[model samples]
Target: MAKIRITQVKSGIDRPERQKLTLKALGLNKMHATKEVEATPQILGMVRKVEHLVTVVEVK
Candidate 1:
């Protein structure tokens, strides 16, 4: 599977609980935190949920 880098660009503060939890699920706890993960559908779905709070970069 391909890989992608997810970075928490914005804070989850004042956001909904679900979004905050989604950030945590993606292993993001602080701003600018980055996690490299497989580009699986389930993980993609989670990213879609918090797209506003993060930035996704495809890893070559």
Candidate 2:
């Protein structure tokens, strides 16, 4: 499977609990944090949920 880099670009403060939890589930705890993960359907779905809060890049 391909991999992608997920970066937390925005603050989760003042956001809904669900979004915050999603961030945590993606291994993001602080601003500018980045996690390299497989581009699985589940991960993609989570990213879609918080697309505004993060930036994604396809890994080579």
Candidate 3:
């Protein structure tokens, strides 16, 4: 299975609760935090929800 690298590039202090939860679900609950997750649809959806608070890079 393929995987992606997720990094908390920006803070989510004033962002919506749902967005914060999305980041947390992706294992990036803090500023500058980085996590690697399988490239599954469920994870992708979560990332999309918090796209504004994080950066994603493909892991080959």
Each candidate's TM vs. the true structure? 0.98, 0.99, 0.91
**Model 1 lDDT per residue over 1-60, tens place:** 999999999999999999999999999999999999999999999999999999999999
- Tell me the tens digit of each residue's lDDT in model 2 across 1-60: 999999999999999999999999999999999999999999999999999999999999
Q: What are the runs in model 1 whose C-alpha is more than 4 Å off?
A: none
Q: Candidate 3's residue-wise lDDT over 1-60, tens digit each? A: 899999999998888888877777777777899998899999988888888778899999
TM-score of 3: 0.91
What's the lDDT for candidate 3? 0.86
**Model 2 TM-score (2 dp):** 0.99
Which should have the higher lDDT, number 1 or number 3? Answer: 1
lDDT, each prediction = 0.98, 0.99, 0.86
Q: Which 10 residues in a row give candidate 3 its minimum summed lDDT?
A: 21-30
| Model 3 error, position 24 (Å) | 1.1
Tell me which residue pairs clash in candidate 1: none
Error of 1 at 1 (Å): 0.4
Off by over 4 Å in 2: none
Alpha-carbon error at 35 in model 3, in Å?
Answer: 0.3
